[model samples]
Target: MSSRTQHSIIDLVSLEKEKINRLFSTADQLALNPFIPSKGFGKTGALLFFEASTRTRMSFETACAQIGVHPMLLDGKSGSSLEKGETLEDTVLNVAAMKPAFVVIRSGDDLDFNDITTKLQMPVINAGWGKKGHPTQALLDAYTIRKHLGKIEGQKVLIVGDARHSRVAASHVELAAKLNYEVAFCGPEGFLPERFDVKVFKNFSEGLAWATVAMALRVQLERHVTKYSLANYRKNFGFTVENLKGLSDKALIMHPGPINQGTEMDTEVLQKDSRCRVLDQVSNGVLIRQAILLEVLGGL
Candidate 1:
């Protein structure tokens, strides 16, 4: 019923508990030696990103190259056929005809990949889908947290900021639930999700006290329909220098970048805070993606 058992990862909820652990194991091994000896010598992967990206796109391309898989990247903005008003299906058909081993796609329309399994001949990994989810990001995030905290289960993770529109937040909430990790949300009232069941905190101090991992999400300004005030958000909900200094010794600071520097967190927190693992998250992204590509392309 869910895409979890399928070759592509469209939803983290579809991933069984055992699969998550296995993936983490594979990622751990891959992280130790990211530049591998060509597990996918003859394979090719097509990466179609319809939205703006820096980390996901580069990390996926790097993963393909390092794993010995040729990566064919398509940016939807430029000379791509989508500019000529070509249907997404037609574009996908053209790409599929090239006979790639798999496809990693991120579309602005969150529902574009709903029927992806039947539309393409090869496996399709949902790189990202609008407000719905970013399964790969969530997977890498889980792997990163496991690496830092020694385990995922039973860990209290406080996901703060713009939770309503953040696909990363959506993915992590689901993934954490599946892995037995406790998750909570903290954000401005309008920015929080209505369907999430976890405890919602109005105070950052309370959130920090309740969490071992404090994951600050970027404000989705691109998706917000109303005017957002950075100054107001920072004063009420952001991770300030004061907050960082007061954090528990065992607490770890995390953020899914590109950070709003002074908005979601003070710039100094990134520089002086020793517990921030934003860069580690970036590094783990490539390894987790490599593991995903290998899993689909028959090279592990």
Candidate 2:
């Protein structure tokens, strides 16, 4: 079934109509409203991330500011007492002591503790939770999909590149399934996620030919460590100009950025493809994240 539910925007299945409507409406009003750099004076806040971040981190900070919420930023790796053997739950719980409207986190591993995800008496919005989910990215992606395609119910959205290992792709996979998209995955054969119901692919041509949206993932610099060979990594499942020709004219291109040049994809494709919305993805992220933080922290 559709992921738009009623109260919670936790997942696609749990997202409801009114909540979505509110989000879009808020975003619309925000666009038409004033120009304030720091609108989030008292309503919102953000937590630090131990891992590297760009879109996910700044977008959340921007989102909160758009909705009039002041931010309390922290560094994930260097901030707090985490280096002294502090657990994720304890650290989050301690941060919660400040009684900020909501706590946003981005951990590299998928460790959804009850104390953090459920306890703490306040809402905990996962900025990009471990290996599990990046709900904000999913939101912006869905928004981008809807903006470009109008509706996603039956769209054949192919998530190519690093299928299994990406928090972005993983979240997209789960949400795509929940929203009834014809979701498929592609990567180096052995790198694909084994647990999902989506169709997996090894050949870029076959994957691109049938897709309405071709979503490439970022190739981490550590593909050498994970896969043991950069040359093989490029040869196995990398995206090149040759693969681009396989896409149908109706097909739109996408990528989660911080792109590894000439590794997973060609930079020119992002620029040359008339249907590419990679920049739009970042722009929409700020709007969608504003929507999420507002819903979670607005009334509280």
Candidate 3:
């Protein structure tokens, strides 16, 4: 039996490349299947959102059904007890009674996650944790990049947009670095964190002046509650129509989705760029997420 515990996905650094490759290979096979994945879920069910999302929910649901897990979901807003006053721990504990193979939850704060995972006996995957990490999205994003570029390691990837507020950006930085991709951090000085090891670029032109893939992180309005300024951030860190013109032609483009039009990118560039593989990214997510559920729970 595999000694690797169900809870091991908490840190991508600890995951062996062979295991990840197996998941990738499995996801690749699912693309040949005849139907769309479902809302019923398969072996691994999700808690879904503490925050709202579209692609993450759809792809996760699709992935679960494709793997044959019966998905049970609870959107806290539409729910009964939650609106009345049920704690996250209580909600998770109550849900575990039905014996889900796994639980994936997106929490509001990084530290808030400990309570949820601790309350559930089954394996749990963190969907996104505040400004800290979006592990699964990173996994699917990397899967898309590998599929699009036909490889992952040693590729040049430029991450552009609001680095400070994006958990996706933080997750990708760690993931890309682990995969041996040469990663660059691109954004305004105030929005980009100074702690990472990658090369940093204040100007969009400088970030595009390389043979590399470009990933634009979204600018969420919630960041204003923190140290970052939204208006200045939009003006400086935002990727403009002009910047995309200078990017490497062969380079693939990526985003986490619900991109801020005119903020992170121009509408025309998003619609027309050959390198922008955003749609493909979501498609790839369903496959990748299906593989994740399969790994944690025995599946079809």
Candidate 4:
């Protein structure tokens, strides 16, 4: 293994713009030739997921395999000591005792990593932390925008739908401030956050007309306390092909998935729309995550 100092990726705010750019450049290289020489042979890392996931978990595992690292999957809910009333910090420390190179965590609550990072010798990568942030997802989203549009700065990205309950939207808002882009929110009044500094659009059509990129967010029904009509939501906020006609032909469409098919967007919009970058987001996720692993593991 490389003798470089360890690093943690907890949030986008903790990263410098130059470092972010370097990661993007590394991702670009990996995109061209994914068969880069492995620098993590015989090394191991841990994945601790307290929240349910599909893309983030699998992408991290796949990235580990590509770079020759063994990924140790830890069941945070059922199989681990977490089931036996062990604290999250204690569980992490116990895993650290095994001396893995790093740990990627997707926690159910918004955890402060400062205390945890100070106690560990290895790196800690935040996969997702409640509705606070998903740094890696934001990274890949930005990368996708940059890849397709040739730039990210100054681009007007209108994030539509459940802003109040979306960690993806939260991270994007933070990233927009850091990366010099315009980000706005559009959804039902109750679905939007109570207090945010960015612009909020009441009209989805107007939002589409103004955006250089239209990012649709999944309505987090699971997080909702009071019941609301899915049909009403679809009627008001759904991104159908007809409704999205106000969006420019050159503008890109994005969604951080497990999309609620007809609720968030029409099937045709996700499937037939040539401007949609949902698959590009998924494919870039792997490369961006590979770059992330390389950075934290000191392989780059």
Candidate 5:
């Protein structure tokens, strides 16, 4: 069995390429037979999400159930103790003391996982951590890309919009770079992150033409770095219907939802014929997370 106990997927680059490939293979198997029997039966997983989530939360819950693990979810808006005054550390201690099979936490940007994991005895998976990284998303994204495109290596991917505040984009960048995929970002001037050797395109059209995959990102209002110009955003960077004429037929559209329909992409672009893989990402999320759970709960 794989020995990924106590491992936290903080960043994609930190994971060995072989392990990643193994996880992807596992995910592919799980996708083929979601109801297949496996380990992790009778085990419990804690879902402690401090932020609002749709895909990550639901897909994780589905994965746990599919893998025969009981999942106990704790949301920030659900009148949890954290809403009153309890600190994350205190809450973590109390939760960890219960000795659940594993803990899946989606904490704020500042909560350092490197420090937190050292203190924990059980595996602590990062569901999402601030604007830093969402490793699982990256895994599933790579899975989706590989599923459709045959391989992630040598694929030209363009991550568009909200680059600075998107944890998914950061994770994808690291994963793409590690896997030797050519990755670029296209967004407004101030929205892009400061440091990265990869190419940055100011024009989305240029990016769309160059990439085999175009991954659109949501404009995060929660991370409020600068004012979003909707008109300019649609004109310059969005996957508008008019721009579809210029888009390469070989290039497919992707979005880590929940998408702001009219903002990053037009409503028409979401249709079946638009070649959008948003639903594929959602489908792969379950299998990828199942692989994560299996890896972290290895042989326990």
Candidate 6:
């Protein structure tokens, strides 16, 4: 792919519905045949995570491996020039110098990737960018919803908890109109965003009853300055079996994990509820990421 056409997967809102549909179609193919022949043999990709991650990091690496692409991971925990105060842009430029076919970045701070992308010769994928957006997560989530509910349009998605600091929620809200799904926020006033055009539910029960999917979000304690009581949050907003009673029979439970057993949701709810599609979301993440890698790397 030419540098101009090798677009970065940074913002879902910038992508046309046709392009998003193409990604979903590609994910579907990978889901049907996970062992499909590698199309990216001998290519190398960079995984630069300035923030902590589990599913996004591992799944992208797995996707790269499946496509016969070598993944070089640079995490914040590990020693790097970043620890020596090297700027993220400089680090990315250094990686670009190595001629990696693509680079996936997850940063704690919201960054304007346009500047970096303009300087680079390779495709860039934003894994997560602070509370601004996580387009790949939104793509995988839309894929998961489609797989389970059989379609994306006309479904209601209730994003519960910590919307103020959730990139996942931000991305979902941005993509919701494009995908033709109704999305609303349900959380405490402090956790909710300062401004949103969509519906906001102060009462969790009302939101649950109205939604086709209930996606729980972790309270980012690490990101918060004000202390919060876990017990209070759980009693008011947690997805316990009793609280889940308000949920529609057909409604699916989701979490962009790691799930806080007693805080965001009950352990029983996550483990025993057949309606919970958390694992499916995790499983589908790999396929969606594979599709993304292939698309960005021009392997598909």
lDDT of candidate 4 over 1-300, digit per residue (tens): 222123687777877888899899999999988757666767999998878888999999999998888999875578877788888889888988999988888886745666677778888888998877899999999999999999999999999988998889888888888899999999988788875788999999889899999999988877788867989888777888778889999999999898999888899999999999998999999999999888877656
Q: Put down candidate 1 lDDT per residue, 251-278, tens digits, no spaces.
A: 7899879999899988888877888888
Instruction: Please write out the lDDT profile of model 2 over residues 174-290, one tens digit for every residue.
Output: 676566778888877656777677787777678888889888777654643545455666565555666677887776788777777677666777677687888998988887777
Residue-wise C-alpha lDDT for candidate 5, range 162-238, written one tens digit per residue = 88888888888789877889889989887788867779988777887888988889987666756777888888887
Query: Per-residue lDDT for 271 in model 2?
Result: 72
Stretches off by above 4 angstroms in model 2 are 1-13, 28-41, 220-236, 298-300
Itemize residue pairs with steric clashes in candidate 1: none
lDDT of 5: 0.82
The worst-scoring run of ten residues by lDDT in candidate 4 lies at 1-10
The positional error of residue 39 in candidate 5, measured at the CA in angstroms, is: 2.4
lDDT value for candidate 4? 0.87
| TM-scores vs. true structure, each candidate | 0.94, 0.85, 0.88, 0.95, 0.94, 0.96
lDDT of 3 by residue, 1-300 (tens): 232254436556656677778878878877787243433343447555777888888788776665567677876456557787777666777777777777777767734665556556677777778877887888888888788788888887788877777888777777775777777788766567766666888787777877478888886556654555656665665555666777888788888888888778777778887788888888888887777776776434
* lDDT for predicted candidate 2 compared with the true structure: 0.69
Predicted candidate 6 versus true structure: per-residue lDDT over 93-203, tens digit per residue: 998899988889889664567667777888888999977899988888889999988998999999999999988998998899799999899988789988578889999
Per-residue error for 200 in candidate 2, Å, reads 2.0
In model 1, where do residues sit more than 4 Å from their true spots?
1-5
C-alpha local distance difference test of each model: 0.83, 0.69, 0.72, 0.87, 0.82, 0.87
Query: RMSD to native for every prediction?
Result: 2.0, 3.9, 3.2, 2.3, 2.1, 1.6
Error of 2 at 155 (Å): 1.2
Best by TM-score: 6
For candidate 6, list the clashing residue pairs, or say none: none
Superposed model 4: Cα runs more than 4 Å off: 1-6
What is the Å distance of residue 81 in model 6 from its true position?
1.0
